[model samples]
Target: MFERGTPGADRIDALRGWVGDGGGLLMVGGYLSFTGFEGKAAYRNTALHEVLPVELLPEDDRVELPAGGRASAVGTGHPALGGVTGEWPPLLGYNRVRPRPGAEVLATLGGDPLVAVAGYGAGRSAVFTSDCSPHWAPAAFCEQWDGYARVFGGLVEWLSQ
Candidate 1:
């Protein structure tokens, strides 16, 4: 996952190669992800951007929702959303991203891509446009949300396939 800090060119190239050769990649969002705080993540110009399913905006894209935002599965049947049903706990915030052509939006929050997946050569990649824990996810989402395991586990399962 390419989060807060930018990886060196060599590392970025290697990661691109690995994904092209069937390695799975998952990018998680946070204050330090995709154009992070003040655009610190800086992945838009990196090789990692090539494999992502979303286009990173140039500026800081964090959106804070103190009252929380609703997250819902997009389609009727996406494996990544297996077992994940009903109203999800409100999220504190997420990074804004635009889905790329051929990418599948598995979930959304306020019409924004919350979870998305795409194929990268022989491998698969996914993006979770929100934190998996804390501030964004909130304690309820981490500890009490019944679909947590299904949501995350299904993502790994889909990527591995």
Candidate 2:
């Protein structure tokens, strides 16, 4: 959502201030999130990077899955994944990220984090390191997976709480 110059900087500062003041924030991955397709989603160079529960890669971090990929809820039984269990529907791909120390790793894809969360001041933040739609997420994930709503809904509810 950040553009150029002062406006983008303002948005970054505002988001930090808002989250620190008890607002909820969520970051979904894509060609414009974290380190995008060609490094266009350069949040690694922004202040928003610190508020996330995962460390952003300094370069393009997209993990392509031309043959598709799947994710699994971690063993922690986090409320954000309340009823989600077993293997997840196939995903076209996801962004690669490392979980920050003390942050909760709710789900994983291969050896990388698929979902992570952290407390930011009085508020909270979460990251879903994959797309919610086409390209990265296929219909099986966005339209057919029964846990989609529950997982995302639970995240929103958790952050809002």
Candidate 3:
């Protein structure tokens, strides 16, 4: 289960139901992801928080990262990162995340966990700090790095597995 464009209590409830019903979710980051800027995500009541391996702090100036400036080591042991090899191209930006207890920290940025994975009942979830597009990750949009495809595709496969 994936939801985009809106974040609120209704959507959060919907996501919770989906996960509880055995559906996997990949909540992409954006103005609508998690508790977006200005607390627009407040209505969501953080319901999906339980399903995530990380906690989203109130969006502050902290979310900003220079475009194409840094890269983190991929989790080679994890299937979601298997095909993504080599020095990663820079990612323009990513969401700021606080890891939850008992969560698997897969990748990090400057001492912060950038990617995380967690299991919830019969399903699971993965949190990618950056937007899954060229704008936020120009390398992904240009295909200059095969990492984007492998990371996202591998995630879908892992969720199903």
- The all-Cα superposition gives candidate 3 an RMSD in Å to the true structure of 4.6
Q: How accurate is candidate 2 locally (lDDT)?
A: 0.87
Tens digits of per-residue lDDT for model 1, 1-161 = 45567654588889999999998898998998888999998898799999999999999989888899989887538887766778888889999999999999989987889999999999999999989988799988878888877888988998888
Candidate 1 local distance difference test against the native: 0.88
TM-scores for every predicted model: 0.92, 0.92, 0.80
By lDDT, rank the candidates, best first.
Answer: 1, 2, 3
lDDT of 3 by residue, 1-161 (tens): 24675654576678878876777877666556666667675423567877887877765413666645465655668875646655667666666678889877777765666667778888788777667776666754437676777778877887766
User: Ten consecutive residues with minimal summed lDDT in candidate 2?
Assistant: 1-10
List the candidates ranked by TM-score, beginning with the highest: 2, 1, 3
What would you estimate as the lDDT of candidate 3?
Answer: 0.69
> Could you tell which candidate, 1 or 2, scores higher by lDDT?
1
The parts of candidate 1 lying over 4 Å away from their true place are: 1-9
